[model samples]
Target: METEKQYVIRCGNGYVRFNLDGSMIGCKYKSSKTTESHMKRLPFNIDLAVASGIIKIEEAE
Candidate 1:
């Protein structure tokens, strides 16, 4: 049977990241509409995004 890769989601105030299998050799949301507006202003790092769980490792690139 096929299996899915393990991952972890680390969400912050503005963005979220996807950690593939966790411990990839590196240390390491959403409230409402108003929060969404603020989130847009903030710049979320893609590296962190993938680190959390939002984007897949391959998707990082």
Candidate 2:
């Protein structure tokens, strides 16, 4: 079985999580009022976006 790699990074005015290859998994805002806007900028869901399945987690280049 393969393993999933997850990492958190500061993106824009919030924080974001993505795979090693830079596939954005989720994001969060620094402020409560702008939380919704931050979430919308992400491509995936933090609660469900995993590195498993067909999503191959590779190294950054």
Candidate 3:
């Protein structure tokens, strides 16, 4: 079976996961200084993230 491809971006002290269609899957943070509220304030769309020019996209597996 074929599996769907997903992308990830490193945002601040965490990482954001999304699909090719620009839909956000979720976000995870490794630092205790980060929180969900902080992430929500950031862009969630792929285009926005790219336009911001602060995030790097990578294929998930």
- Per-prediction TM-score to the true structure, in the order listed: 0.23, 0.27, 0.38
Specify the highest-lDDT model's number. Answer: 3
Return the clash pairs for model 3, or none: none
* Winner on TM-score (1 vs 3): 3
Candidate 2 C-alpha lDDT tens digits along 1-61: 9543333344444554544343654456422122333434556653343333322222222
Off by over 4 Å in 1: 1-42, 59-61
Tens digit of per-residue lDDT, candidate 3, span 1-61: 9544544567665676544344554466422232333335554554565678766655544
Local distance difference test, each candidate: 0.35, 0.40, 0.51
Give the count of colliding residue pairs in each prediction. 9, 0, 0
CA error at residue 19 for candidate 2, angstroms: 1.8
Give me candidate 1's TM-score against the actual structure. Answer: 0.23
Q: Pick the candidate with the highest TM-score.
A: 3
lDDT of 1 by residue, 1-61 (tens): 9543333333432434323333222224221112222323445554565566664422121
RMSD of each: 13.9, 13.0, 9.3
